[model samples]
Target: MQLIGRDAETGVLEEFLGRVRAGESHAFALVGESGAGKTALLQHIAERASGCLVVRVEGVQPEADLAFAGLYQLLTQLPVRFDQLPAAHREALRTAAGMRPGSLNWLAISLAVRHILFAASDKQPLICLVDDEQWLDHASVHVLAFTARRLGTRPVGLVFASREPSSEIAGLPFLKLNGLTDSAARALLDSTLAAPVDPAVRDRIIADAHGNPLAILDIPDEPLGGFALPLVTKDEWHLDTLPDETRRLMQVAAADFVGDPVLVWRAADKLGIAARAANPAIEAGLLELDTLVRFRHPAMRRAAYWSATLPQRQEIHQALGDVTDQRTDPDRRAWHHAHATPGPQEAIAAELERCTVRAQSRGGLSAAAAFLERAAILTPEPAQRARRLFAAAAAKHDAGARNQALELVAAALAGPLSAGERAKAEQLRDQLRTATSLMDEVRRAVEAGGNTDEVCIESVLEAWRGVEPTTADDYAKAVLYNGIGRHDAARDAALRALHTPLVITELAEAAARTGHFDLVKALPDPVGDWASGIQARIDALLTEGAQADAHHRDSITYLDRTHVRIELARAHLLYGEWLRREHRRIDARAQLRTALEIFTSMGAEAFSTRAQRELRATGETARKRTQPNHNTLTAQETQVAQLARDGLSNPEIGTRLFISPRTVQYHLRKVFAKLDITSRTQLDRVMLG
Candidate 1:
């Protein structure tokens, strides 16, 4: 049938292809329910993609257990010159494909895939289509997703069609395939039918199908009321009604996954089943018998395989296992044999455990986890099962399935683990918890401006103790040292973290405090309001009189527009000191008093004492404020206050902090109350300046 009801989606693809032809790379994902035209749309794009090197692979469900299976299929289609790649990348790809013996580095493989695609795209624009991405092997999908996201400026376009959306590829543009429009569904249904239907029956069918094209065309011949199945349920009811021999044949075909006719026929012959048994299923529009024994839909194969009794399924697996060529495909044979064995079998479990090692060697953490989990189920000994489960949990954790890893670890811990095993499992659990906790703490600290506190820094440092230091940790240390009046250490740390936007303000402050004016002058122009404020402060100290006055004014204005209260107060104090040197005692007193009031209220005694000293120089002894309010800015309130002062909308602030806009509004209410301000406009005068 001609593809229908996707003009907008097709237009997007056309434009995307146009861009690819113009030497800009792009990636897109097609997300939809089963049979909601993802495959059809992908094929449509491929057909229209003239002059492009199109490479496509359909993720086979049965092959998902095989490490790098989907990637192997894709690479085999490419005209890759392995010799052209960097030596490490070449070795990584060769090892992954079993062409060379070496440890598999998934990162190296991902990078190599990118190099290969970019090289190909230099000659001709490339279109890569992955159909049924949900069924792709975990390792292959990860590498492909990684490559797709990093394909900047290359003449390539990657399109993935999947029933379920994956977060790993969530960065790619997604076209969600909902049902066809009413008129379009009618046109499609009319095209499929040989005879005209009554209008009432037609409307009923349309409503039942919910505009799903597959359901509209494949509605059973029986009366609609008793035979209708939703798109989600698919054709399970129809599969159930087939003759017993046909159902058995369908099951056998389903079990011969990848739809290889030779495997299906061989297994059937062993079971003494005639090929004619497939006729009933083919007549029912559920099976397509040709060179490959295939199902009409992926759902149909699932229905066929699941419709069989456990014992019948086991028999089918055994028959398939007996016919499988072990020398050529030991993994498939072992998998089938494992399925055929009803209870725990040590030999089969050992074979599956060996498969885990092979999968792990290929950098297939998820596939290894699957094998280990299955082996655990098949291991007769409780201690061995516990150990296997723990190993699977570690693999799962490495694969980024955090919750599943936690559950598996908990299961392992509850079993009869030895002291060492139990300690290791508990450590894994602590690591998982700490991972999440540290992320939350860092986000909270950044948003709340609480990273300056000694207690907060110590807590984070303790949590991060044994981990290798990242650039982010360097940034954190910069902020920590700056807060503790360690300018030299802060400047060193800030220089190490100069690449990040958030470190710009800290770097400027630390460099200026340590008499490194030349360092600030050599830095790039600041972007954000806070960074500009700090930059202006540095400029003020390097200039004189009117220029100095203008820089200080600009510094205060810019600081007032950001969430950095401490920086803003520092700006006010610095400007006051400059005004004092200029003999503008009246202006200096105003600026110094404002700084002293804010610093004292926030319990920043050091800055407050400096402000008091500056005030004394201006012939005014500033009164000490009532002891600082213990109920000053809270964690969330401080974040909201800073963002609001910085001129961000509630929605934007909420998005930054991963909270709802209403929650942002609620936090803002508390912030305004804590800062003793009624409107955001007053934030600059009271908190920022």
Candidate 2:
């Protein structure tokens, strides 16, 4: 098939291929909607590229949760020698491909895949084409994305086609395919149709197709002058013309999403469908039988699946569930079983909950949220559903999806719940609100003439009622009181929360206004390299001697973790205040400005005000300025950029961050775009300035 209206995209692919042939590496993502010719473009590249070993794999929806399914498909097709890789890598690959009995180690598997691809590319230029990448199993996506990013000096070119945006490959170069241009659309139409139609009908078909090549070809030749139909509707109409058994088989295939012919055939066989039933679908150009069975276009697959009756769809899902291998593909089997059960099923819900936990352990927060959300839907009892919904909300919130978390919390609240469950749901809601409205909440509390000590005590008592007090709870109380200037209460709470001597630094700082210099002197010697301990040592030195400058530098250097961001900001604020007290006005201005930026960005109104006061003491005006867009880079991106500015290569950055080199490059690209700068030299100026 000729690719129409993708000359520019094809050119980019060709250039990448050219680079690979010259022993340079490249990776690109082709992003577009259904019927946007992504598949066609990939096939075009595969056919046109010369002197390269092309390995193609596709994401199958039905097998999305079957870990490493896509990677197995790609690796099995290549001439891979397992003996060439490290034993860990070999074992991981063997486990992933179901050839060995062991847990799947994604890192080991990623390394194995990279080593295999590197060896292959050394023999011949290699091209990897991944189609429908959004449907790829999470494990496979991670490994491939890792390998693609670290191709480095290898003669490899990686290309992916996805219908949805994916954060896994967020920073990769992408070619977005839109609709075909007018001339290209018409040319495609003329080539696709053997017989000429009325000019008016042709014009109408062109307009209705809206430049989608597949939509244009699917239009009926006998269309009347006044007739109109939606693009996918036309494709669904064509599906309606197929025989019952053939159509049902196609519907089953569509629902399979993985488009695996074996699974589809097995499911169809259960429905009494013979192999011949698939012939008609193939003849209709709506189905293809190759390494995998797939619809000609994503739109046709959607149309086929949606065209089935609800009960029939359930039966198909049940059939798939029955055939899926439980050992190797438990998550998908569980999902299919859940979908097949007409109503709530406790067993399926429990299985999905387990899946959610596994996903969370892998840092797949979105996947964990999805699993919990689906588990909630499958829960039979109202209270169980409410609990599941609350769990899902928590997972979503942890994943940085606050809006979705709020929506889930609202849904949980509407469900039948016990008082405890309801309270938990309300608490989650309040937490999310606090994160987004910290400044507003502080202002409201202040305006209402709230006593900081009373409010802090009440909050802690109410939330932790009937439970043993924990170090974390007391710490929260201490922070809350300290924020509102209740030094005595804050000191008391901090002392209670001090589980280890390392935490004495934070407590000492909180108790500074309470004349607790004796408490500071009573602390034991530091034990470990904990940040809290480090900060405390710095604080003790600053308090007792002329080492405030050195301590300030040391405290700031240890402020790296996300959990300690507030402490980092406070360190800057206190250091700025101390600098001002010492008449180091210029240095105080720098520290106070940093503290103000951090506090304002975090919506810490009280801390921001403190920093602003210090700034003014340094003879600087603290203006209420809107946040800069350049500061919107995610924490990971900022880290990557900072490491890059420190002259670390992609692999070095990846090692330090515990991510893949490709991932570092991906985040670096985002950082570059966010800061509107193109190079590492520019990054130092933008970040350090």
Candidate 3:
């Protein structure tokens, strides 16, 4: 079948395939909402895969929790020589596929999959198509994503169709499918119609379907009048009109989830449902029963499932569970039984608890968290429930979902937590909050007139540490140096950078510092509020009192809101210097004192001494320096130092702290400076005591 209105998408895919056939490996994800034809697109790609050996894996909803189930499906299709892989890789693959009695290792499994693909592709180019990837087992998704990223010139093309974008597959190319164009929608609707549709009715259907291919096919069958009917109402109409037996059959099929026709029929038999009951659904275009039970669209299946009463649905699940073979697929059986049982059941909860261990072994933290969460819900005891929730939260945190982890931890804390559990939960909460606050601080610094890059240099370094220096980083360094009044350094860096907003600010500041007022004035107006403040500082150099007063006050007000304390103090110092030059001694002293307090607290020696000199000029005696705090390291710096002291390498420390290795190194330098130590070996002696 020709995919309507996807000529552009098809062209891109054709070009991508041509490159793959020429021995370049590529991976692409098809992202869209349900009914957006992601599955149809995958099917179309398979049809066009003429010379390529196509390997298809469709994620079964019922098998989502079964560790490495999706991987097993895809691997079983490929003709790979296991002996060709290294012993460790072969063992890992064997263990993951349940052919060996051993624990699964995620990294090993990923490497094994990559080797298998490369081996399989030696003779023929391979195209692996994954549909409903969101429903795939988490362990398999991790393995596939890892393999896809490292395929470099392997002549393997991996394509995924998923309802939403996944962070796991981030950095890979994606083709997001939207609704069809208006003309395409009209054409598709015309082809589906038995007779001529009313012009107004046709237009309404087209408008309501929003160019969704599935919606266009389904909407033409709905009754329409001069008055418009909502698309949801039509769906409700279909569900409400189905025969009792047919709806029950749908509920059984939906509840079955694996799309196994034999399993569905067996479960239906257990419920005393006749085979002919599925005929009405088939006739209505809601279901297809042949080799397997298939829904017309995912939406139809969902509607069919939700149409049944809660007890009826549970009964269907129970029947499906009863019919499922425990020895072959215990995880799916346990999940079905858990759903069927309404209240807390110790046996079922224990089964789910055990699943978490297996999931974690396969490096499926997300899957582990889900199992723990479900186990918690099924636990009869409050204490066990709280413990399970806490474990789940920790798993979520390790999976790099801090916000969700925070929510789970908070929920766990609200229950009966032991003293140790309470402390651990609070610590996790603090970590999550600190991470969020750091992001907010950087955002505020950027919006205001602060050194945003200084707050994010570690993140920048982490993202680009091993990569060659781009003009972007040069511009960033120019901005950072300019903020510190290193005009020569700023100028040198600006010379190597492109003409971005940041580079412009750096050039203008460098010129102004060198007394080139004309160049500063000739520079284009700065972009954001923070850049405007930089421009204002240059303007202050040219103007006096009231003309620059408003700009100075604006800078102070804006910078004060951000957590970049050093930058805020600098803003105060600049404004105070201007006030003093204008002979406003009283106003100058106030700003100078504020700057002094912050600079002193942060151990910014130069800025603090500068603030003191300004205060002395205002006729106030410079206050004696407060005794320096024994420990002046910020929380993040301390964390980095402790990890370094514990013998963690920079990259390892960065991983634990969720920063970049470069950022970890930067913090280590600060730690060494504060502790009067030249090497990491001294951290143990100086920091421990």
Candidate 4:
């Protein structure tokens, strides 16, 4: 573990040397990331020093950030232990070291040496080496700062190599080395490693390493542009002492590419590790700041990340995921899910896999998409990847992201899928039709009310035209195509269902959502008539006094809970506007609050925000709420609206979202009404402006 790569660190060393040569003790802080040749640079400087006594001291972050752990090695060298220290002496050391008075540790001894070192500095040039300065604990930092401040007047020359900055040494002379430059990295790689690696490989390794010499050194020379360096001893690091806090922080950081600050805070809070302790860990260059926190060095990061068992990692991920899920932001949700350590591959993975399959089976393609996302995180095999891709394609199809859906299908097909999987993927591949037939049929099926016939379940064959498929029923096909922005196709699919006896309720809801409002409004019973239970719920909401019964509505079956919730929310929002138009501000406030609250409670923050914006626009105050799915967009509505807002007329929208011109208008009304803004102009403003 002798030092390496100090050729570039010469300027800082010369500055320190010159200051010492002038008979003035100097303090120079060398700041750099861990595994960036900082330690090697220090050793090189020490080797080159003449008549300079080198004293190397290392500091580390602690579980409590208490003083003394940082200067442990120095303290153990003290002549007097517990036996020779007087009470006043002990008290002074604790205070200087930032340690709890009664806490028994090496801090008192270290503080005593700290005093001695400064006194010696008055006599001769003494180079004090303190590594990992950022992790030195508050007390150590204070003591170092004090020493540095006074050293300029003494004979001591202090040099610190730090990868990160801290509040300490605010004005002291410090040299900061930010990993190697590209040219330096290229040369260093070429020198240290061997030949088979091409220029690109060298560049990639250099880029990935971010110029940390130590990290670069770890890549197998075989991979390092075919360069090979002689082997040294095993991974023996001089920084042998693993402070509990540092160890814990490193372990967590290793688990992800980088840890989220919010997530790190929440995790520390959950684990009961204090902020004081965790902050130092980050400042110490131990954590790589990424979407998730990780070790800055690839070697250290991998070591830390894989330290835990699969089960342990799973628990950590699950904890973080749960915490992040509580956040109403989709970005946060995705972030948390990204790092959720997969728990046991047993039921957790099985459950996720099943959820993905079932969502497809039931025509709840969006759910399939979401569940597949979770599954991908938990499972990494090609089979799982293919399945997840398939499910996501189905979901994208439902959402009207047709191109995106096709891409997902292609990805699934590209996988090393089994015969069944390949056949299914190929089948889906064959269905990329431009027809509006199936899209329309699915719309009408949704218009036909009832459990089995819910619009959410419309798997109309007509919608499946351009959509290639295998083994999937028309219902799955219709719903998926509609979901994927094939509104005209979705409408046609719904229409075909009119001739067959099927659940019209789901169909109407889907059609209504798809912007095929005419079809939705023309449906029978609970779906078509607001006087029916479906419409009655809204009428009752209008009559029942908004906000009085928050979350209270005629409970719709969870079968189409996602759709029903969207509808009820819209009605309530409309009712609030109606109340406001009538000068019932108080009533409007309550209704709007209720609507937003309901959406929020459902984890539909996007929708909740929409409702809140309306409330704000109308000058009605709304209570804070969190929901996941309240924002309204039928698969059809989403399609038509997307094209409509793009300046496409009803006919064009019909072609895009896959419905007729009439269907385009049908979805436009819902979009405008749901948005609580009058005119396509407003919709246009929302989209473009």
Residue 440 of candidate 2: its Cα lDDT?
A: 42
Residue-wise lDDT of candidate 1 within 448-558, one digit each (tens)? Answer: 432353223433332222222333467767666655557798789878866554565567667877888666643265666756777788788677889988998888778
Question: Candidate 2 at 242: error in angstroms?
Answer: 1.7
> Could you give me the TM-score of model 3 versus the true structure?
0.42
| Model 4 misplaced stretches (Cα beyond 4 Å) | 1-8, 62-64, 75-91, 94-115, 222-689
- Which has the greatest lDDT? 1
Clashing pairs counted in every model:
0, 3, 0, 117
* TM of each candidate vs. truth: 0.36, 0.36, 0.42, 0.31
Question: How would you encode candidate 3's per-residue C-alpha lDDT over 584-676 as one tens digit per residue?
Answer: 898787677766655554444445666788889999986677523334775556788898999999989966754446546656876787788
Better of 2 and 3 by TM-score: 3
Model 3 Cα displacement at 418 (Å)?
Answer: 3.9
For residues 485-601, what per-residue lDDT tens digits would candidate 4 score against the true structure?
Answer: 455665566566554434233344456445555565332444433224455433333343554233223322211233343444545555565566667676666556555644443
Q: What is the lDDT of residue 272 in candidate 4?
A: 58
Write candidate 2's Cα lDDT for 15-76 as tens digits: 87889899999998999878889899889888977778999999989999998889889988
Q: Kindly report which residue stretches of model 1 are placed more than 4 angstroms away from their true locations once superposed.
A: 1-237, 359-363, 435-689
Candidate ranking under TM-score, highest first, comes to 3, 1, 2, 4
Model 4 lDDT-worst window of ten: 222-231
Arranged by lDDT with the best first, the candidates are: 1, 3, 2, 4
lDDT of 3: 0.71
Model 1 worst lDDT window (10 residues):
222-231
- Residue pairs with backbone overlap in model 1: none
Global lDDT of model 2? 0.70
